[model samples]
Target: MARPRKPLLSRARIVAAAAALVDAEGLEAVSTRRLAAGLGVSGPSLYNHFRTKDEILEAVADAVSAQVDLSMFDESDARDWRTALHDWALSYRAALTDHPNIVPVLARGPGRRPAGLRVADAVFGAMVRAGWPPAQATYIGALMRYFITGSALGSFARGFVDDETAYDPADYPHLGQAHLLAERREKVDEGAFETGLRALLDGLALQYAAVVPDAHAAAGTER
Candidate 1:
């Protein structure tokens, strides 16, 4: 007789296995049979947790989103909100780079998951704590998410392209200049992300800090 199977399969474990597969291979390798085989189980076993591969993929995306750590933003920092926000965005970019294959899936739509909401709340909460109005905080946080995620996906995808492609430098002189700078710098360096994040956060901080004239006056005197 065949040995009995372990009844330990759960949605979480299935998603984890799928994420691991995608991390090792690309997203194309994360089919139902592949996942089941990877877990040393039958295909039907996964059906017990997820109805379809899409569901499994969704779960995996959620699992990855859940992995982002936001503890550093929990306490009040003596640094300005611009510094704090830049750190948060940089940390988020680092986490995204660790799992490039799944970042595209995440970039598509994981917006409604609990983990996704928590990340939004954390960012908005930081802005709120820094004296931004509710509306401004929410808007800026969402904008920051779009900017950071889109930039990361674009940069990672471009890594597959050839380094020596010829282009008409005369037609797009600025882009050619940027290409030169890009070639000189490290490929994985996130200077663009950091620069953009700091500039936007600084603008937001300045706008919000204006509401506190007394604080601004005191800060000016110190400066």
Candidate 2:
């Protein structure tokens, strides 16, 4: 007896389902079997679309990367380097934070993923367009990514901590004070994000400017 061919499941749908699973029930809940169950198919069916779980993650990351508005940073913009860098960084951070379940994964081995490379390309594009040298642009991209991920992780931790811990102001003054700040003006809020992002961008711009004097000079000359 000939078996009927299984209907095609779109790659976009699979990745979107995986992303939804991660959002609903953390990354640990995502597996080939589980996703298949969610998708009304058998485990083997997923392998037809995604070679491995990592591939699925890569696809999901690519979907997330697509959320960034690359057009916002014009290659021909007359804005200064810091302004351009600020625009790029803010957009990148916003996209990452919107996918909180996946933000931590960004710090991990998306190194081999093309979607991850898209992010790097955007950062490099912004810097290069602003007359930054290749080396400095690379440094700025790495620095900004690291800092943004680190800050996001810290802010994200507060939510998990609140759910798990019985925090008291009396025992830990500084932590309590910080918690109070978060409570009154949340870490994940726009103000906190703007402040953290601005501070990091400021430091990065300063360092890149100092070490890449020739590049800075060229930027000024171009203007």
Model 2, span 1-223: residue lDDT tens: 9765865677877898999988778788889888888878888988888899978877887777777766646666676667666676677777777787777677773576776787778778877876677888888778777876776565643553432135555775556434344454354565677787777666666666676676664343221
RMSD of each: 4.3, 4.7
Cα-based lDDT at residue 215, candidate 1: 44
Please identify model 2 stretches exceeding 4 Å from their true place.
1-7, 156-182, 185-189, 208-223
Question: Highest TM-score: which candidate?
Answer: 2
lDDT of 1 at 74: 82
Residue pair clashes in candidate 1: none
TM-score per prediction, in order, is 0.76, 0.77
What lDDT score goes with residue 50 in model 2? 86
Give, for candidate 1, the lowest lDDT window spanning 10 residues: 214-223
